[model samples]
Target: MLAYRHLFHAGNFADVFKHALLTRLLIALGKKDKPFFYLDTHAGIGRYDLNHEWAQKLAEHRDGIARLWERTDIPGPLEPYMACVRAENAGGRLRWYPGSPRIARAFLRPGDRAELTELNRDDANALGKLFDGDRQVHVHLMDGYQALKAFLPPKERRGLVLIDSSFDRAREFARLTDALATAHRRWASGVYALWYPLMDGTAMHAFERGVVATGIRRILKLELSVLPEGWNESLRGCGLLLVNPPYGLEDEARKMLPWLWRTLSEERTGGTEVRWVVPE
Candidate 1:
């Protein structure tokens, strides 16, 4: 849905989960001396002002990044992520938040390149202006799935693709599965990180089955829910499905998810999962 604006939920628990893991993925890619490409499909406005009326409406960040904002006990795996968040709020006041595009740009070495896509005209235009003069970054006003066909198999042969779609439309899960299957076939070696909301059990099972049917291997499934399963709420939790995940990601997630759940869970009811949907 083009009407979906990420600012309303920026810095929420889901953002914490996705952005933290996203930082780890970028870090893993940077481990290699060789330059890597980063494709951010569904890139929102690169930066969000937490004090903006939209963000203040829900004050969601209070439960997400705000909880960890002044903390000194964050695990080692989370340092890079925290550093980025802190960079956005230099005055010690949580005034701004960096979306994936800004976060990805933070880790870009001299040779590294980043491509961000957003379907919303306003967001796409904002994203373009955010990185306007930087030759290393490219912003496109296009559908994320279409971006896969257009930019996959990056010339560098090394990169990570983040598919974060607003699940407001019906059958989005099916569309993501099909598009991913096609993209994987096009560039099987590329690292892909997909974010989705945790839905009903039956729908979740069907989503899993669809991905399984793609016969994609080495899929790492990570999920964190603030509420217990079947919780009747707006959003129980969210998950990140990684394909061809870098080697230490699973272990890193084990540490990060539990800590995030401990800090962000209002009722302390929901849990975390770190497992292989399809092992190598």
Candidate 2:
């Protein structure tokens, strides 16, 4: 599990989908006057240099952020996400990409807070250094699941939690389902976002069933696939399960994901879906 470095896939299609949606979540929180906390489990190095050897090896950004870097027709909701990327790479060249922590930090207001947890030593240390002088942010070098238990029901009592785990370990789907259900029980009001890669049909079905059985309502499921289900490529697509999602998130995603699929999909064989797994 430690072998999986997000730097290798920093600006890949999946990151585009996840980060775009993340921006919306934070924006929604800001709509309310009350302060909110943002938690990033599996927080990678706060930022990524796409020119780095690992990132350049695959040049995933060429298929991800590079597609949107200079686009003038970006949908309204995606403007914020692209702005974050542009901010990272000044001088009109795509050289850097912001991870979840960095994107969340951009939207943090005077009273807003953020917590980032990463089990990987190097990534944790980098994240620590990235937010060293910031008082509104805290970085924890610990297991994301453990951090969930320790930080739930945040004193603010309102915020978003993103569980963007690296699914390098076996049975990660089941583990995520259990953790989500437990977290919902502890803080039903908190917004929870869980990211997972699209994989085997049987496993995905079981994972869906587990979430349904949790008795948690208002769950929204959003997926974007850049390749056919039969494609044997590394990652055909990915999805995010949002528990207690904001009111306008589905509308925003509907407008945003299709454009992403069109821009990032190679063969145009993939698609997007935004629906409620459990309605309010």
Models 1 onward score TM values of 0.98, 0.98
**Residue 130 lDDT, candidate 2, scale 0-100:** 92
lDDT of 2 by residue, 1-280 (tens): 3989999998999999999999999999999999998888889998999889999998888888888887899999999999999898788888889999999999999999999999999999999999999999999999999888999979999999999999999989999999998888889999999999998788788989999999999999999999898777679999999999998999999999999999999889879999899898
Say which candidate scores most in lDDT.
1
Deviation of model 1 at 73, angstroms: 1.0
Task: Report the C-alpha lDDT of model 1 over 184-211, residue by residue, as the tens digit.
Answer: 9999999999999999999999999999
Q: What RMSD does each model have against the real structure?
A: 0.9, 0.9
List pairs with backbone clashes in candidate 1. Answer: none
Give residue 156's error in model 1 in angstroms.
Answer: 0.4
Model 1 lowest lDDT segment of ten? 227-236
Stretches > 4 Å off in candidate 2: none
The segments of candidate 1 whose C-alpha lies over 4 angstroms from its true place after superposition are none
lDDT of each: 0.93, 0.92
